[model samples]
Target: MDLQLPRGMRDFPPEEKILRDEVIAILKNLFELYGFSPLETPVVERWEALSAKYSGGEEILKETFKLTDQGGRQLGLRYDLTVPLARFVGMNPTIKRPFKRYQIGTVYRDGPIKKGRTREFYQCDADIVGSSSPLADAECVQLALDVFERFKIDVVVKINNRKVLYELVRAAQIPEKFTEAAILSLDKLDKIGPDEVIREMVERGIERTSAERFLSGAQDPQAFKNSEGYRELEPVLSALRDSRVVWTPSLARGLSYYTGTIYEVYAKDSSVTGSLAAGGRYDNMIGQFLGGTEKIPAVGISFGLEPILEVLKEQRRDLPLRKTVTQVYVIPFKTLVAEGRAVCQRLRRAGIKTDIDFSAKGISDGLKYANAYAIPFVVIVGPDEVAQGKVKLRDMRSGEEQLLTVEEVARQVAQRLS
Candidate 1:
């Protein structure tokens, strides 16, 4: 049988993995800089825990992959990190209020596989729990902007509030029961276009004229400052006034948990479509985990690592690939293998990344291997060099060779790399 990876899965080779790691590191650093502590949650969650009620809404629930363990316990791979976070907050009341945390991990979904969408992907999430302040929401937006800015990627953050969406729906005379459905349909405005979205709203039991009116209101942010949604969103806009954030009333995030501000991020110019990151306020989700009576104000944003990577790749904005972690390659002549090991050990002890080639290949082959991996330095230890207690250090890039003591070689290479 031929070996093949499952559909919608991916194998990240060394270069790709390095880029992914770099992105995650940047996100983690920014999250920490913004006062968010690191957190982790299990990949597998109880099916009951991730049902439609708590885990966003029916849309996400439908995409969740369900399974049964040997003990007959029903479980599902987590579709998103936010649900697990809510569960954690609900179960751990002892944790200090207004808990702020960031999580970076892989999540699974059984949805259709596409360009930026996959069955398994990484999500970097930062959340503030227990704070109703719009500043918290603004902070999330700022963090998102900071991440993209670091990448040198131009992006626009579209901000909206669920309460504002509700007002628009009410103005359209769309019944309250169809609000969720209407928002879900509106979320696809960019993809399906206005005509299709209006048809969807009509199908969802909203009047055609009302649907058009609601969508028109979404296009005009200034028309609804006195409305509840805009009133709630005003502080957030004020806090992020210096940012590239815009009031996008049509951006009703698909999640059912968002009770207030919702946002979606997009690359300003790129072939990669869809949001790079998105999140919003979910004031009632944690309370639902506790009992649905208590209201715990919470807001967060999750960076879609996969889609960001897609954009980066399309734009060719990637870090230089280091095929090997070894910064120095030690190549020994036939009988000087022992000396090579000693030199490698000395360099490593000095906190330098060093490797000794055990292949016993000639100098030509050794240089070939080092060059292939883009290793910057190659050390040649032969009888003459060993007797002199020195090694020939060759700068792979410049082809410059010099005889130096082991310590000198280590120091020089470290300095050059640094």
Candidate 2:
């Protein structure tokens, strides 16, 4: 039998899964606090919807895990949450306008398997649909900023409007047919440098001078003052009060759906090379799902949970080392297992994560078990202590034991853990 996981697959044991779950908890809490409602969608979609409406571009479609069901229906695992959101909105015509939702789920991509990326990973997304106002874009940026800040990861955000780049592409004499390819080539500027970007543009049939003009125009967003992209972007920049944000005219979000404001988040003073989160204004995707040119303005941010997990692991300061969620472990004298069980019930009812040893083991073995899992506290209930309605609470880390009433133990453990 094969014991090894497939390529780009991993098993997060208790120690790792605990940390990942904690991060998810914090994210879900923050998402709600920011006024976004939770949503869920199917992981598999019809190949037609997945391939057509989600046309994030050729590069993305190339990574899709396509399959055909036994019923002869073509299907594919969703590659991103945004596309699912668009499909959901388009299918439900009676849904409320300006729908705001957040979803965290697994997405599959058969692309490059790097440290921060994988074939299967979780995507945490918050999106606002049916709203075209630039404020929607700004709000998405703010959410991304707040998410990283809360995670103690310092970051800088590069904001750009696709319209801004479109005008510049036109200014460079790039024909409409070559606009998307030209933008995609320029998206590689930071990675491949100007010579390569120009080379790529030339390869895409753009004139050498026109490619150079496109690169030069990226440095100046004000050059297209009268363009609609500039007019729409001014308010987004103004509304973004965070000092971490900056307007980059050349920031093509590397996605075909982004038709307006786009942003990418990068960690500061960190070794991670990928953006922690990214999203943009995709006004035409939903309209495509609805089979029309009528734009349903949508903007969103996706927290690359795997990358965020990598960042958290790299820092190590915030990730707890505990292999178990048990905050307190209970051990009772062989004759008093019932009493110990009662105490554990009380602790759990009080909303504390508690575990008890049902084997009625010796105190030494009990304490050793707790220590192995890094359980912070141990409650020893012997006959004498049980008689007085008190127990011996031992601090595993400090090796200090205190004789206290059950109430005192509960109160102290709750306070310390809280």
Give per-model CA RMSD.
1.7, 1.9
For residue 401, give model 1's deviation from the true position in Å: 1.7
User: Each candidate's TM vs. the true structure?
Assistant: 0.95, 0.95
Best of the candidates, TM-score: 1
Q: In candidate 2, what residue range of length 10 has the lowest lDDT sum?
A: 50-59
Candidate 1 clash figure, as a count: 1
User: Model 1, 246-340: lDDT tens per residue?
Assistant: 88878888888889999999998788788999999998889989887788899999999999988888777555665767789999998888888
Give candidate 1's root-mean-square deviation (CA, Å): 1.7
- Give the range where candidate 1 is weakest over 10 consecutive residues by summed lDDT: 316-325
Q: On a 0 to 1 TM-score scale, where does candidate 2 land against the true structure?
A: 0.95
Best by lDDT: 1
- What is the C-alpha local distance difference test score of each model? 0.90, 0.87
